[model samples]
Target: MEGHIVLKNVQKSFGPKQVLRGLSVSVKKGRSLVVIGGSGTGKSVMLKCILGIIRPDAGEIRVGGESCIGLKGKDRDAFLARFGMLFQGAALFDSLTVWENVAFGLIQGRGMARHAARDIAVEKLSQVGLSSDVAALYPAELSGGMQKRVGLARAIAADPEIIFFDEPTTGLDPIMADVINNLIVDCVKRLGATTISITHDMASARKIADDIAMIHKGQIIWQGEANKVNVSGNAYVDQFIHGRADGPIQMDVLKA
Candidate 1:
């Protein structure tokens, strides 16, 4: 598929445990794919593999038809320049001011002048509904929602071709989470970037996803358009979306 990021038969392992097993999925160009799954289902591992943070032990990962595995030095840096990520905790730098944090990649990675980078950062912050004054504040000075907004702004600061959002709405109140979800949808629409987001929040998924895929035990069990997730009929999908305790999907937790 044109402009698609495709993963085929990818696998990864840690110690005696296997994390990803033959995981495969395609995220079409300029569309959002939200992955849903229980904890320990290898969703994060799969995302890392795609981002080149964690290399897969086997199989293929292609970004726009070019294989991305084992990339090095300038190649890896250039490849990474195509991506922006919003981490689960917002993951802002406590020491840097908001705008500096937003411009980190442009300044450090691309060697852009600080003045130029700061202007771009301020612009991106405005896109996320933050004012220029907020740019001067440090991450620790902001509330959770504000911090997430800064994270979102930073993610789009470089206008990346692909963006990854890891549990974007986690750690926020319901209203704040919804606000963040709306911003995410709006930002992605404006950027027209291909995105892959992983979250347990079904409401966020419904609001932001074009396609939804479910991961279980390091494998994709079901995949379809966002609207069709309700009717997926897969036991695990149904259980997860409804958040039911008694279902085919059992917890791996050891009972006390």
Candidate 2:
């Protein structure tokens, strides 16, 4: 079977700093792939390249066999409609009500009627373990965990074919993070959606990923089943997973 989403020889540079250099990886249909890396390892940039948010300086990005680079107008809009995203920090709009935020894509992107979108929004909120009463509240009115749940509801509201989760458990407590991870696993299963998630949290990655890929210096250094992560043998992978300060991996810390 072919990869549902594939990146080949993908290269991207911002000014003098090269982020993704010949980075390549693939995810099969209905499978979840989690990308594990530390800060500035091009994890988020890879996702943006796929989403067309940041154009790669060079390389190819394809979804379900079609090249997604350079898509414009309706083509771009159509391409984006097939995917959902849950950004770091939830990234909710303070001004919009919870339901409005969840329904934004349906009503704005698809031009669905307000009533129809609201109904779907309510249902999606419930799927994320939220109640209908919370739908009317603003982001500030909810706890951090509730806001994350709201972000999750919005992500699956459109029933997207693919989902990109950017640090889904970043600020949550361990229990709530696990809860979000469970919801992510459940939601992906329910939608039968292929997913690519970027996270530093090993627990989250292990829970949501069928396959795990470790990226370093703008390339995929290792890829394998999630169960094998601890035994991957690669020194970088070892240092990362074990949170070791000494290894092949090095952090750039400037002296004051």
Q: lDDT tens string, model 1, 32-103? A: 999999999999899899888898999999998899999999999999999999999999999899999999
Clashing pairs in 2: none
Count clashing pairs, candidate 1: 0
List CA RMSD, all candidates. Answer: 1.1, 1.0
lDDT of each: 0.94, 0.96
Per-candidate clashes come to: 0, 0
Candidate 2: residue 244 lDDT (0-100): 93
Model 2's TM-score against the true structure: 0.98
lDDT (Cα) of model 1: 0.94
